[model samples]
Structure formats: C-alpha cells, structure tokens
Target: MRNPSSTGAGRLLRATGHSWRGLVDTWRSEAAFRQELLLGAPLLVLVFALDLAPLSRALLLATLGFVLVVELLNTAIEAVVDRVGADWHALSGKAKDAGSAAVTVSLLVHVAVWICVL
Candidate 1:
C-alpha cells in the first residue's frame, strides 16, 4: 500500500501542478521569459516545417527546451534574491549575475545547435 504522500502517481500529480503554477507566474511576471517564448515558438514550428533527420529535430527541440528551463531557473534565483532583501549585497548581485549568465549560455547553445543542424 502506498502512503498518502509517497505514492509515485500522487507525487507526479502534485509536481505537475507546482510546475504549472511556476510557468504561469513566470509568464505573467518575466518579460524575458515571454520574449524567449515568442522567439522559440515560431522557431519550433519551423523545425517541424523543415525536412530534417529525426535526431536533428530532437536535438533542436531539446535545445529550445533547455533555454526555457534555464530562464525559469534564473527567474527563481532572482525571486529568491529579491525576497531576501532590497539592499545591495555582493552575494545577491553575484547570484543574479550567475543566473543571467546561465540563461545566456543556454541561448548560445540553442543557437549553436540550430546552426549545426541547419
């Protein structure tokens, strides 16, 4: 018998809900997230429109997903930093800068993948 909080399906459902909430919040609050979505959405459709190998298509899609994941993580970092305090701190600045760098790296990877595949 699965414990109330330990069942695999139950945990998955809860996680899904949490993820949906995060996505909605990010979409509403983050202009960068919205812009990335706008850029990625059309490119994703174009990926489908082009004649590409299965592996190439999968890699292309995965790179786009990586960008979104990185952006979400960056947003989370910024939110936590802001929650901690409004005062300027070196550590806080480092955290936010690191998060931004991660997003930039992800975008670069996405571009590189697309260039290689096409």
Candidate 2:
C-alpha cells in the first residue's frame, strides 16, 4: 500500500500521466482527434495573432478547447460501445449517435464563437 501522506502531489502527477497517456492513445486510434489537433493547433496560433478584445480571445480559445474535449469524449464513448460488443444494437447506436451529436454541437459552438468574435 502507498503512504497516505504523500498522496497530494503524487496523486496529481499520476493523474496527469494518465491523462497524457489517454491523449496519446486517443491520438493514435482516433483519426478525428488527430485531424482536430492538426487544425486546432495552427488555428490556435492564429487566434493569438489576431487583434481582439481579451474576452473575445479567451472565448475563442475556450470554444476551440471545448470542441477537442467533446471529440475526446465521443471517442471514449465509441470505444466503450465497441468494447461491449462488435455487433449492432439499437442502444449502442443511440449512444454513439448521441456522442457524435455532442461533438457536432461543440463544433457549431466553435464556429458561432468565431463568427461573433470576428
């Protein structure tokens, strides 16, 4: 068993490692995640390059991050669905669709934020 007193910083570091591993695994397995990172990366730099109010800049950045977060969640849902069974099922389909819709809504929000800011 681990020492309870050392849990604070140690736990945080371990959690960060797990999160990084998840990101790496997602990048490897999910093409959509890779594509979003590819596009979002340069777009993020461009966002900083633009002359805008501080709030607008922050909103734009937050929206971009939100899309990536949604995409990761969608990927996780799809993975879980696949793991449960490879066969087609109505509930599985519904879950996957809902996850996809979440990503779509996030993308729409990103676009809307950009439009409003620019």
Candidate 3:
C-alpha cells in the first residue's frame, strides 16, 4: 500500500484521502464515535461563544479532542481484534476490554477538565 510515487502535494492528498475514508467508515460503524461527535458539537459552540479565558478555552478544546482521539483508538483496537477471529479468546477479550477502558478513562478525564474550566 506504500505509494512511492506519492510525493509532496500528492502525498498530502493521499494521506488526507485515507484519513477521510477512516472518518467516514468510523462514523458509519461506531455508535460511540457518532454519539461523542454529536454531543461535542454543541459543546464546541459553547466553548467559542463563552467569555472564557484563553487557557480555559484551550483546555476545553483539548479535552474534547482527546476524547475523540481515544474513541478512534478504541475503535481501531476493536476492529483488529474482531478481524483476528470471532472465537472466545481471553487475549482478545482483554484487548477489547482494555480499549473500552481507555475510552472510558479519556471521557472521565475530559469531564473532569471541563468541570474545572467551565
């Protein structure tokens, strides 16, 4: 899948395309991703609309971004685990559980940060 021919703008374009495809696919397949996005959308507006300090705004933005990033990572982990097989494997369960726990921890941190800032 490595495109040696891609250089400069072509490379950027291809990378962007790959990212776009991932986002679209994640949106379609992951309910948590979609829900987090939808919930964050309004909070995004609130962050900009409020008269908060610069640092507070940044913290708010950072947490929201972090949540999405963690969610995406979790989804990727789940997909890889599922691809390996549907059989009952303890290691697979551990991997998936760990990924879910990561997402939960991220959301908890995000909530804590927002509570402090807002």
Instruction: Name the Cα RMSD for model 1.
Output: 1.7
Ranking by lDDT: 1, 3, 2
Tens-digit lDDT track of model 3 for 10-107: 89988999999989999999999999999999999999999999999999999999999999999999999999999989999999999999999999
- Cα TM-score per model: 0.94, 0.93, 0.93
Which pairs clash inside model 1? none
Task: At residue 61, give the lDDT of candidate 2.
Answer: 91
Residue 31 shift from truth in candidate 2, angstroms: 0.7
Q: Score candidate 3 by TM-score against the native.
A: 0.93
lDDT by residue (1-118, candidate 1, tens digit) is 7588657888899999999999999999999999999999999999999999999999999999999999999999999999999999999999999999999999999999999988
For candidate 2, what is the TM-score? 0.93
lDDT of each: 0.96, 0.93, 0.93
lDDT-superior candidate, 1 or 2: 1
**Per-residue lDDT of candidate 2, residues 1-106 (tens digit):** 9787459988888889989999999999999999999999998998989998999999999999999999999999998999999999999999999999999999
In Å, residue 97's CA in model 1 sits off its true spot by 0.4
- CA RMSD per model (angstroms): 1.7, 1.6, 2.1
Residue 86, candidate 2: alpha-carbon lDDT: 92
